[model samples]
Target: MRHLLAALFLALSTVAAAQQAPRIAVTDLAYEEQVARYFQYTRFQGKSSHRESERYADSDYSSRGSARSSGRTEIDYESISGDIVYIDRGELRKFTADIKGEMLKSGVYRVVQAKPYTAKDNEKLYDVIDRIKKGYFPNADYVLFGSITSVEPRRELNPIQGSDAISASLSMELVAEFSLIDTKTYEVKAAFSAMGEGQDMRLLKDPGQVAHLSRGKVMREVAQSLGVDVATQLEEQFNPGAARRARGDRYREETIERREERIIEYR
Candidate 1:
């Protein structure tokens, strides 16, 4: 009888706790490392510069029936910026800082913000778990760790010959890895990876200008979408058995038995 009462009390406590909103802390995504990683895949075109020169020397017609050449000098130069993806080269604020605010806008998780952390790109899962265990966010039940693993930006330029103008189209694809770690148990409850793409185009004298203006817009927009997806995935992970329990499937379960052979005799 005592064991039965104890089991009932524990089950009620679990149900009560599960009803509360979960506190989630999302760390910053490493921005600098991701940008450097993308540079590795960028292939630059060779002989990116073009130069032309023409020179003619004046020569008097000798005693032959030859004409004299006139003096002339001409020069031309063209330089194309190598396949460099020009983003604001300023101090790369932690992607984590920006992403955390974006995640909060989703209003899906009870997101908590902490003082900016100095954790670098090399921060590991164990290190994150330790921070949470040390009461980094006292109310947080889970800490989300994320980093940008890959980014690919594609740019297309088409010159409209009529008006001396160029049309530029830019697209960026980003892939990131996110982990949700439980504070108490220090177990990675979920690992979620998602790819998001953003695109923008512009018509300007220089095709390269399109990317300069559009890169920030695309990445900023992608970050918002990325935040929502991560939050939704973590919510599902935190409630793995909620769907089954809600359907009255788990509530009716009896003693565990070999499911392959045993059938419920008294359903």
Candidate 2:
């Protein structure tokens, strides 16, 4: 009789504990080709201009006889400008993973770390997150989701009109947004955004190196900030505390310092 009673109590405790935990689901950074641009185009005299040409079939119907088709070619020269939703696999992996990690560490809620996804692969957010919603984290109560609205890193190489010297510049800019929603009701609980930008200038034989560095640093730094921002917001909503706030501020300060140092070193 005692064994049976103890078993019942243990089962009830397990059930209670499970009930107290809330499941949260997160998705990858969503983006479309139109929005997935990574660089801004500035006219660099003869350097930045390029011609794009394409050919298509032009079919004509002859009133007297058979139809005739001829290949028609057109070409255009255009300068790239504005925000692009360029997808960098490494950049995105670091981003979504970090966000998931921070949410897990908060311990106030259960996070369902979602699988990898390419936003452009699916046309709709539901299409991107459907598998995770239906198969993986089906029991989640709330969903945290969003997209990479803009990703543009500036790397300019300009040759002085009068001199032979070339000036190289490195800069990174990334922006992401999120919507926290109640899964059952599909109501948006909150919306948030985070952005990161860093830049440096130096004369270099390989201007590409500067651009690469900027891309890497900006992606990682932006990811960190996004993770912290989301985690802090979640903390405030679920379990508010002065200590957590202080710790988060300290972390941000350190990140800013490191970012400054990295840029300054290139010069």
Best by TM-score: 1
lDDT tens readout by residue for model 1, 19-79: 5546777766644342421322333343333445555555576333334445544455444
List the lowest-lDDT window of 10 residues for candidate 1: 252-261
Quick one: best lDDT, which candidate?
Answer: 2
Q: Model 2: per-residue lDDT, tens digit, 125-200?
A: 4442464455544667777776777878777888766665667777777777777777767677667776655566
lDDT, residue 37, candidate 2:
49
Query: What residue runs in model 2 are displaced by over 4 Å at the alpha carbon?
Result: 1-19, 35-94, 115-121, 126-133, 156-169, 198-214, 237-267
Give per-residue lDDT, candidate 2, residue 162. Answer: 67
What's the TM-score of each model vs. the native? 0.51, 0.48
Residue 128, candidate 2: Cα error in Å is: 7.8
Clashes of each: 2, 7
lDDT of each prediction vs. the true structure? 0.60, 0.62
